[model samples]
Each structure stands twice: as C-alpha cells, then as structure tokens.
Target: MSEGYQIRNQSAPHFLTFTVVDWVDVFTRKSCRDIVIESLKFCQKNKGMEIYGYVIMSNHIHMIIQSNDGNLSNLIKDFKSFVAKQILEEIESGGESRADWMLKRFEFAAQSNSRNSKYQFWRYGNHPEEVSSEKFLWTKLNYIHMNPVRAGIVNKASDYLYSSAANYVGGEGLIEFELPSNPIIDVLRKERFNFEIDEW
Candidate 1:
C-alpha cells in the first residue's frame, strides 16, 4: 500500500479507484460491467453504501463513496469479493471470449497473495482519497465524469452511459446516486479563478 492511499476516515466520503488485476480490460464486456453495477446496487440496498458519483471504464472504476454504517472498509471488501466471484464465474462458464487468457492472469495474480486461492480479479488497495472539502469533491466529480472524454470514449462526458455524468445534468443514470448540492457547485463556479475543463 502507498503512504497516502489508505482509507483514513471511514465515515467520510472518499474518492476511490478499483483496477482490474494486471489492468486487464475485463469491463469491456457488458456482462462484466453489469456485474459491477449489480454489486454496487446490492451494497446500496443492503450494506449502507452511499454513492455520490461513479464511472466504470474498460478496466477500472472510480467513485465517490461513503458508508452509512461507517464501515467503508468492510463494505468495500465485501463488494470486491462479491463482484470478483461473479465475474470469475462468468469467465468459468465461458461467457468471456478471452476467458482462458484472463483467468490465467487472475490465477497468476492470486499466487502472490494467500488470501485468494483460485483468482484475484481486482487489484488490492482502493487508493482512497478522503473528500475533505467541497472543492475537492467537485474536483473528483469532474475527474470521474471527464474520464471517458479523456479516453476518447465519448465526445462529451454526459454522453457516457456507464457514468453518473447524465445524472448531474438532469438525465437519468444507470444507477441511482446522491447528488452534490447545487449551492456548493455554484459557489465553486464563482470562486474559480482559472478553472479549465481540459485540466480535469
């Protein structure tokens, strides 16, 4: 683990990233993406997860998340475990065209850690950054929304279907999430001296 990436404040909202083992592009598949979505929904419904923003890319995912029960660590652990199990099952059932290759990579990743016996789908450590201020929150939100645009996946952030960008602009998203207050966003806009969309 890195020096600053640990989840220091469990109850506070944190910007988090989850990467696939070996950076494999497993999420390129719709079924793989849905597994992540369904896992998040399960967490929200049964585990007190409060999602503010999220974006699922081809190989990684980012989100602004907090736990209603102040057990962010455990919630994240369970979420990853469940998602990994589901994804691995899909691969075993021959749902993925690259299943053999991906499974081999996952198996190799598991060898380094005794915790995972057969596979290690997600990389360890979430690289959690606590949302310490409204400005920081806005910054992460912009980064999350702009990810697809930066990757050339879409012409506009809100056009990305696997992100919360649409929800920010009054359009429905694939999953429900809490929105940052308009007043705070307004304040940030007014306070910006030289904010640039390209920078995000």
Candidate 2:
C-alpha cells in the first residue's frame, strides 16, 4: 500500500473504498452481493473485523472498520482478496448472464498486473482514510449511509437493504456495530446523530 492510503494505525477506525476492476457492475447480481456480505460476516466473526458502518454499491463497497487483534490492515487485505476470489468463482459457475464480458474484463485487468495469474476482479488499493476525530468519523459514516440514497436506489438511507444505516435507527442488520459502552457513547454524544438510541 502507498503511504497516502496505508493503514498506519492498525487498531484505529478507518474509512475505506473498494472498487471493482473496470468499474464493472458485478454486484448488481444478488449472488455477487451475497458473496461480499457473507465474506464480511465471516471476517467479523473469525478475522477480527469490527465494522462500524458499510454500504455495498453496484461496483464498489464503502466501509468504516477496525480490527480486534490490531491487524486492521492485514484483515482488510484478506477480506478483499477472499471476496475477489469467491466472486470470480461465482461468475464462472454458469449463472451470471454477463459472465463472458466480465471474465474478459477481469482477464484483461489481470494481464496488466504482473502479480495476478488468472483474473483481477477487484481494483488495487483500498482508498483508506483513518478516522482520527469525531467529526471525521460521522462524516464518513454519513457519506456511507447516503451512498445508496444518492444513487436513487432508496428514498431514505435507513431503508437501504445493504447498508449499516438500518442499525443506527433500531432495525435488525445482518451484522452489528459494537458501541455498547460509555466511552463510545460519549463520543457519539459529542455530535449527536439525527437518530436517537433508545437504550444502548
């Protein structure tokens, strides 16, 4: 990773963007999206990922994440690498209608990079920004929540099915964001969110 995007503070919260090669709309398929969602949940359960917020878009994903084992950088690297492999397999398993075109694009991208032998599903570099302050944290979280809304996928961010906004508004999300203590609560109170937490 380059200096600008490296996860310098391995234990600190970070905002990251993972884009697909050629900006392909592979995630328009539910199967592809589910692969990503499942990978994220796996990372959370086994790879020490603590996801504060996330949004899965058609060609990319945005997230605010940290690691329990203080291996945030490596955790993200593994997550992206694993998801890329699984998604490529899904495309080639004979269900995707855009299989041929997507594979060709991934193949072309892989050929451009000496490290990849077969295909490059995800774009290199997860544009990472360390969340060092309360304002910056909320800024990234708000941006993440509003992504689908801005894309016109949903009228309200909280209504988006594949985002963490639902969790903030007291809805059941696929994964939880752990903020169940005093210090974290104090952090959120510094700049109140639009929604209220009935009981933390």
Best by TM-score: 1
lDDT (0 to 1) per candidate:
0.87, 0.83
After superposing candidate 1 on the true structure, give the runs of residues whose Cα lies further than 4 Å from its correct spot: 184-200
Q: Quote model 1's TM-score.
A: 0.92
Model 2 vs. true fold: TM: 0.88
The residue pairs that clash in candidate 1, if any, are none
Model 2's alpha-carbon lDDT is 0.83
Off by over 4 Å in 2: 180-200
Report the lDDT tens digits of candidate 1 across residue range 88-189: 999899878898999999999999999889888989888999999888988788889889988999987878889998888755788887676755675553
RMSD of each: 2.6, 3.5
Clashes of 1: 0
**Residue 62, model 1, lDDT:** 99
Model 1: lDDT equals 0.87
User: Residue by residue across 1-200, what tens digits does model 2's lDDT show?
Assistant: 55678888999989999999999998899888888889999998898888889999999999999998998878988998899988888889999998999999999999987999799888888888998887788768778988997898887777888888888766567676674223464455335654444321
Candidate 2 weakest ten by summed lDDT: 191-200
